[model samples]
Target: MRDLTSTEEFHELAANSPVVFMFTAGWCPDCRVIDPIMPEVESTFSDYTFVSVNRDAFIDLCIEKDIYGIPSFLAYANGSESGRLVSKDRKTQEEIEAFLSNLSK
Candidate 1:
C-alpha cells in the first residue's frame, strides 16, 4: 500500500484510478490489527490502488469524507465514490473482502 502524501495527491489518484483510501492512525490498535492482513487483501484486490492515509496527518480529509474511525476504507473510481466501509468498529478480513467484492454492485 502507498502512503498518502497530501490532499492534492489523494484527489488526483482517486480521480484517475480505482483507489481505496484506508484511513488509519499509527497509535490505533485496530489499525495495527489489520496491518498483517493488508498485504493479502491488497493482493486479492489488485485492481484497486491502496493508499494508506494517516488520520493524524489528514484530519481535515477524514472529516470531509465523514470518516470518524481509524482503519476505515473509502473506495473511489472515475472521480466519484464507489463504496466505503466507514465506522469505528474493528473490521475482520471477511468483512473487508465482502466490502470490496460488493463495490461493483
Candidate 2:
C-alpha cells in the first residue's frame, strides 16, 4: 500500500483508476490489526490502487472526508466515490474481503 501524505497526492492517485483510501492511524489498535493482513488484501484486489492515509497526520482532510474512525475504507473510481466500508467497528479479514467483493459488484 502507498502512503499518501497529502490531499493532493490522494486526489492525484484517485483521479485515474480505481482507488481505495484506507484511513488509519498509528496509535489505533484496529489499524494495527489490519496492517499485517493488508499485503494479502492488496494482492487479492490488485485491480484497485490502495493508498494509506494517516488520519492523525491529515486531520483537516479526514474531517473534510467525514472519516470518523480508524481502519475505514473509502473507494473511489474515475474521480468519483464508488463505495465505502467505513465504521468504528473492528474488522476481520473476512469482512475486508467482503468489502472488496461488494466494490466489484
Candidate 3:
C-alpha cells in the first residue's frame, strides 16, 4: 500500500486507478484494531491503488474531504467516489468483499 501525504498525491492516486483510500491516525485505537487486517484486504485487491493517509500529518487534506472519523475508507473509480466505509469496529471480510464486488461492477 502507498502512503499519500498530500492532497495532490491523493488526487493522483484517485485518477490513476480504482483506489481504496484509508484515513487513519497513529494514536487511534480503532485504526490499530484494523491495521493487521488491512494487508489481507490489500492482497485480495491487488488491482486497486491502496492508499493510506495519516490524519495527523495531513489534517488539511482530511478536512477538505470532510472526514469525520479515523479509519475511514473511501473507494474511487472513474475519478469519483464509488463507495465508502467508516467506523471503529473491524469490518468483516465478507463485508469488504461485498463492497469491492459492488464497486467493481
Clash count of each predicted structure: 0, 0, 0
lDDT of 1: 0.93
Ranking by TM-score: 1, 2, 3
Number of the top candidate by lDDT?
A: 1
Off by over 4 Å in 3: 88-90
Better of 1 and 2 by lDDT: 1
| Predicted candidate 3 versus true structure: per-residue lDDT over 1-105, tens digit per residue | 778867887888787778998888889887887778878888888778788889888888777877778778889888888888766556666777677777851
Global lDDT of each candidate: 0.93, 0.87, 0.80
Off by over 4 Å in 1: none
* TM-score to true structure, per model: 0.97, 0.93, 0.85
TM-score of 1: 0.97
- lDDT ranking from best to worst? 1, 2, 3
Q: Supply the TM-score for candidate 3.
A: 0.85
Which candidate, 2 or 3, has the higher lDDT? 2
Better of 1 and 3 by lDDT: 1
What pairs collide in candidate 1? none
